[model samples]
Target: MKILLRPVGLTFFFLATHLLQSQASAPGGSNLLFYGVAALALIIFFFIVVSVADNFMVIESKQMGIKDSSTMGLFPNIREFFRGKKPGYLDTAHVYTLTKGYDIPMAGAPQDVIREPNVTRFAVTPPDYFGLRPIPKMLVEEGDVVKAGDPLFFDKNMPRIKFVAPVSGEVIGINRGLKRSISEVVILADKEQVSRTYTLPGREASREELVEFLLESGVWPAIRQRPYNRVADPDIEPRDIFVSTFDTAPLAPDLKLALRGRMDVFQAGIDVLRRLTPGLVYLGLDGRGEKDSPYSVTRGVEKRYFRGAHPAGNVGTQIHHIHPCGRGENTVWTLGVEDVLLFGELFQNGRFDTSRLVALSGDSFSEPCYVRTYAGANIGELIAGENVREHSRIISGDVLSGTKKSTDNYLSYFDNQITAIEEGDHAEVFGWLIPNSAKASVSPTVPVLSNDLHLTTRTNGEKRAFVVNNDYEQVLPMDIYMTQLMKSIIVNDLESMEGLGIYELVPEDVALCEFACVSKQPLQQLLRQGHDTMIAQG
Candidate 1:
């Protein structure tokens, strides 16, 4: 099956390319030699394109409630989609809680949880992703006794930021959350006042000093940079830095909530990050309805408003949009809003704090809210109660891009929620052909069904080969040509891939493209291939 399927898939791609070229108008600057080969390539390409287009099954977005004309671009053969009967769910996984964590379809089993040093406690509250202007304040003031993981305060912002206690002890002096009128700080002290303190391995401090300190202290693993999503190397000086104040995915956790009461740690993290990169550290925030931010302290940090979904706030996307990477350029590092404080505290005192805020959502989940969890900790404890409804699918992270990890699986570098939805079992006689009105999203491009605000926990359609040209670009905010880049990488055309800005991409950027692909190509694999290929060449 693998051998037969692989060749067929490749044939489809080659044919698809020819089909696109034929449809597109050629540039006037083209020479005779180029045209000769292009024409010859077209001849052989036509047969393969026609064969694949004829044999393959495609579902039209129009019938599925996709009204946009532009969506046809994602799928090569949009006209044939509405031809026959509609199809049902292609792949389905039950959302369950095992010893590992939440069980998802795509992500498989979760990796073992790794506990870094100096973790203090955990705390959280309602509305993990809230709008700006109303950052939550800590419930406990200076010198107040609190549990290891307790609710610090409710965010004053729209969605509400729930501050969690880092350790069980008396409250310490608030940091910089306080302002002329608004304040948003929560400080926790260790009960013994021992674990609360952080110290570098050596007394002397310089840019290299802190780097060496973090590397030796085991807190170095806490700093994760992008492109490869690995721990930032202390030895290397990063070209750029990125920080996001909020997430724009469907159910992303609000940084304001996660960062509440930890403004000092956040400030400290920023200081450390700046030392590693002489270039600017771009901080992304939501511009829509944003008021004054209480946690922002980095003096020269270039702040930008992310106005779209998913990748809009992705550090990789921000870097690609702002300062694109060129050949031979070093890495660009990024930090999560909450992790910034953790790093700060790690150097300020020697304590390691790994607690984080996790959001629980999905159609099958009875309770959809944010829970406090320790970094790299097992997810089973965070997502509680009867998660599975008869047979449901639980995915860690956003539905479109997240992996279907097991309940026992540990969370990854930049993830916050476990979304559970019912495994769609119902079959339709003409599901694909019919104008689906039962609140199904063919892609973000469809109007009647695309924005159907009534998305439920039920798997409306089966996860077949990703069909439908959803507005993946709307969610994926990047400078690279996602579609073209994927093709170049697949064909191993290094020069074409580089020309299309392959260096500025990461696997997560293609997650939306994968979800919105009509061909259901594994976009993540394609991105991974590009990254691996580029790295290998380097």
Candidate 2:
């Protein structure tokens, strides 16, 4: 029966094609019988193709251990570019360090610990602390002793939002910042066991109900929308959603570790996001995740393999390839994999319960591993530096993209990694043109006699204008023109930036461009500037 059907299927497909072609060639006196037969054949052909594809479909599962060399790992790739080239500037690159007063004076003795003005009353007044898309109703007042993960406030506009407590302390403080007119709800945690479970709304949640749930629960504040980079408006429907698993910047977090035990939460978050958007959730997995994720089209999720150097793993590149945000028609909302858990927590309970796993790495560190910490939590408690290093620069994120954090400073909204590299006082000889083998870190174009990956993270060459043209293309796996888009952003060309798709990029995405940059320009600053300009204009 199967063999008989095979010939019938093929014959019908060809017949349909011929009929359509004949109609195109001879429009007048078209046969009604031919039209009916062609329609049937076309439908049958579609089913046959679908059936075969379903049977032969491959399912890729994301596993923990899979190590592959970088695109530069291929020898011919490196040699092909360096063929018959005298290794001088590429070998001895001249870069200018653009220090924009980020350099802070070293703390004299014990640095004063200043409580974050925002987190002061966060526990008692959770909703007041976080900015929701629409404002929420204040639940509790001052001096209310709240337990960890307990609801603080709910969004009045969409009441599902439930802001929760970060620590188990007391409600000791409450005050307002000068401008922004946002309330400051302080919560000191109780340190006692608080019941933290709620019945999750199953797959049957209606769009209106889900929006209400998020607002009342307080987690709605976490879902920020783009165009203006403001909190997402529940009233305004979005076109698609984006989530970046790993940050590929200089001192970015090890997202693989961050998501290690939280796979369930991550999946839960993805599941929730799938509800809000009409299109597919394009998972921008680095080459690693693309080969591993296991999801079919029925799941409404599509996976694309992003293989690049630094910014290659960025969400901007992912958006540019999978679902390019259009001008005034399509809007893409991007979130870090770490924060997605907060969305998942919304359904489980009215609490903000995700403490991210971040890493602190640079030339100044003797150890670099994942640290379990919460958003807006003080970093001084987790970092230990008195042993081997002194006078080192402590960066809040990756060295290239991160901000200069005070020793007394708590981590801010955009930090995933804390890098500590030494601000060495070693002076060099005519550093711009010298073979910086001992001090410089170059890519395929090594300095005169320097090719070592196992060296300290000190800048060997003088910071000139950014110039090294390493293998950015080899690592960047996006379809859009990266260099051109970057140029448009620099010039503040809003129309061009939008045409080139600026909505896909966050500051951390451009860190790799800074790391491999020969001109040594701060690419993050440029990206942030563009983001700010766009938001302001909007």
Candidate 3:
């Protein structure tokens, strides 16, 4: 009907205009006013009819699960382009071009070459995880001999989820922290590592069987749910599962190197994850670097290409764009690329292989490159003989959002990169007044000659008043008002936090915002407090 009406409307409009022109040319213009009024009325009626027909078409297309590309109007696709609404599930991949973000250009990105590090000591720290009890029930005692994948400890609250050892080793030490809280379970890895094997689930296995397998095999901790960024509950099925195939953090490892020769294992992992959720498994890919990459050809998942600066590779940011988590009872599971490989190893080899490629990067080291090691490897052994700068800070992950650690500390369970940068404790004379080209600044006052900058552990400025401005919004790519959300979280306003889309965020999502803030407010810490408050309320 819309197609037929187009020609009829055009015909009436032209006829009325021609009649009006003829009447005006006639002497005294007797019927000029009548023709003019008729032409004006016809124009208005034609637009109204077309608009109604367009609405009907849009509604019909939506009902039929079809994209609304056709309309009897001036511009059909302009509205959609401005709205930036793209379907998460489609035959072809969806591209998300995020413009609101800042990529910190830091020196010391790892080389493509992978090296085997001599990391013998490994430890499983319960405090590394969020919401876990400070004193978890220990499954192994000191001097106990256990194989890789053996249960080290279990949270008293969630006894089903077991935290396992990364390698065959003996329990060397069980260290405690403030208030005698269990800090680290140190292990001395044996030369010949052995693994505990289990029966692989069948292809026709039920969801319960798969969940039970994951829980018992100690791989459940890899799957963390948002809204609190804690371990996923075994009983409640998530609405969707998300995985980011790349990392965009400063001095972060190239994930393509990690995925090398592990394509089959990665696919098997994706297959296992598909059974855990009824919704689509979303894979966020790097739009700038995924061309000809192995992850591009990955099957059985919805691929979303993200292009932008830092935090573009963050899974939380991707989740916000694709399918945001709602305030209450909307759970979304997220995992890293390495976590998926562990799942594949469990199903294929019948053992939880925690082997991963850790990138040793930053300007502190003489030669930065990739290191092949297991999870929770000792920081000292990983970079034992490397030439490192004096008075340097060692971080268990990337500089941004990574935990600070000493040489004696072990890597975080979820970290795949270790960063070392110079400490910024020394005082600088006239540093605030002088503009140094060597320093990298988001502000135009300090000249940044190149994107690759040599940064230190310096805040540059101290915390002062929390001014209301667009500084956070300039770096945060999501739709949430970052400044307002931070303020709400500060006052412990639960109602305002939920309404501001706090459920859709984790600490890493706002790490860039914290970095870009002129006030230097600890946004990540503040966000964690908000999460704790929300969890306590329930």
Candidate 4:
């Protein structure tokens, strides 16, 4: 199955090079020498011309483009990305600028939730990657009175990176799953719970000192590494850091609107993150909007604009485009803009300030607005008002990559957007035959039913065999052989996975691949399992 179903993208690449080599060595080899040399010469010439053209475009773009607020002199990432001598990685600067993706136009997200709501409860869980679980070390038990900034729990594997209490509250209870792994650390907020203060060092701290400050203050787990999408190791030094300010997912919240008055803390957070990596700190913004996008106004980081459909605002996409994560390149870390402010505010004010603007969106709700609330806050009241439909799926994050939760469930500790989507169960007559113009699908042969077009908690169809269609590649602008990687993962071939560049791939990186897959095989779950298997074998 694996051998038979290679991704077309890789197939064309292999044939293009290997065909020339094999033919050159065939019968009457001496007769074909001139043709082979001419072909090879042309290929080299084409490559040189393209590189020169790209360099010209970069200079022209810089001369005409407006400078960002903080002009950090000489970014090495941009330089290395263009003049890179690495194999298996495309020059992303050109690829990203030319890439295009499908846009799922969702109404009601433009309606920002701007009202400040009261918060009396909060919860923190070892964030689940969909149904995939994590092993957590419990730091506090129920009925224990804890102050804000106090460590609640941390990954037992990476104990130095602690997950802290978002609010000053009493430990009410714990939510667990199979195997008794720690789940949610439910906190009943007193609102006046003791302030676990953070004191900044007087002098500018060294790299180790800054790491200690972030670790001790319980804010270290906020930024996650890309290779495994796991909590970054405290001991390992990062190569580069990525901070994303906008989300390009369907019904994504507007960062410019969300962080309107929070630039001070945002800048402070950027300063702290700059110390984490000796390399560049890249900031990705939504370029589809205005020329002066609010997030583009920020200072003190390497700025890059990505204007495309969904996943354009994804940190993995930005990182891949700006600087592709290569083999053993585990130093890249991505943090949300809101989480950036969380660390900054925690460091500056000496108390945990978990208040952030969460955009509640979807067609289910009556008024989809941005609400000012703290992390782990019981979103029950926030989304309790009259909604358009029932059996709605309330997720703590965006449509893609967000975890599924009930309306009563508290927001995930790491999520900044809560979404409510309608339930999907009913199957239509000839569902795969109806053209779904209302919704966007990568595949053209398969027509998605109109009623099936909307967001739902259900997988519209059943799982089937792997089909190496161009649909997945059309939606994903990243230069990866999706079919080859998926086939390798399905067979649990670690060597093949590594050789195919699975190091740079994450669950979210393949979310679109799953959606576009006619097979309906859960691609995210497979990627997670494959990644974990690699770690377990090691």
Tell me how many clashing residue pairs each candidate has. Answer: 41, 54, 0, 5
Candidate 2, position 235, lDDT: 77
How close to the true structure is residue 326 of candidate 2, measured as C-alpha lDDT? 48
lDDT of 3: 0.85
Which sections of candidate 2 miss by over 4 Å?
1-144, 147-164, 171-202, 227-230, 289-300, 348-351, 385-388, 424-426, 438-443, 447-492, 516-520
lDDT of 2 by residue, 1-538 (tens): 1233456667877877776776766656268547756687668867677545433331111121122111112121332354343223222221111111111111111111211222322222232122343334656667777665566665564455466665555655554434533244555444343535555567898977777766655556567665534457677677888776655554455566555555666777878888887766766654433233222111345655543345655666666545566435577666777667787665544455755655656545555555555654555555743332677777676655566665545565446666676665656567648554444343535543422122334455445653435333444444445566777887788888877756766555555555556665666667667777876786
Query: For residues 1-538, could you state the per-residue lDDT of candidate 4 as single tens digits?
Result: 1211224334644655676778778988765766766766676666556545545555555455433211222222243345324222222322234254666555556384487666677888775422224667778888998988898776655667777888887899898767887767888888565768777864478989989888888877777876887777777778899987777777777777757777777887888888888898888865554354566556778877766677788888888767777535456888887778887786656667877778888877777878877877787866655365677778778777788887567888777778887777766677646664655466555454442245565555788778767877887878788888888988999889988878788887787777777789888888888887887886
lDDT of 1: 0.54
Q: Order the numbered candidates by lDDT, best leading.
A: 3, 4, 1, 2
Model 1 per-residue lDDT tens digits across residues 127-162: 222122334455667777765334456435321223
Deviation (Å) of 196 in candidate 3:
0.4
Q: Which one wins by TM-score: 2 or 4?
A: 4
Per-model RMSD to reference: 17.8, 16.2, 6.9, 9.4
Question: Over 4 Å off in model 3, which ranges?
Answer: 1-92, 327-329
**Error in Å for residue 19 of model 3:** 31
Q: Is candidate 2 or candidate 4 better by lDDT?
A: 4
Best by the TM-score measure: 3
Q: Report the error of model 4 at residue 232, Å.
A: 0.7
TM-score of each: 0.60, 0.62, 0.85, 0.79
* Superposed model 4: Cα runs more than 4 Å off: 1-98, 128-135, 327-330, 386-388, 444-458
What are the lDDT figures for the candidates, one per model? 0.54, 0.54, 0.85, 0.71
State candidate 4's TM-score: 0.79
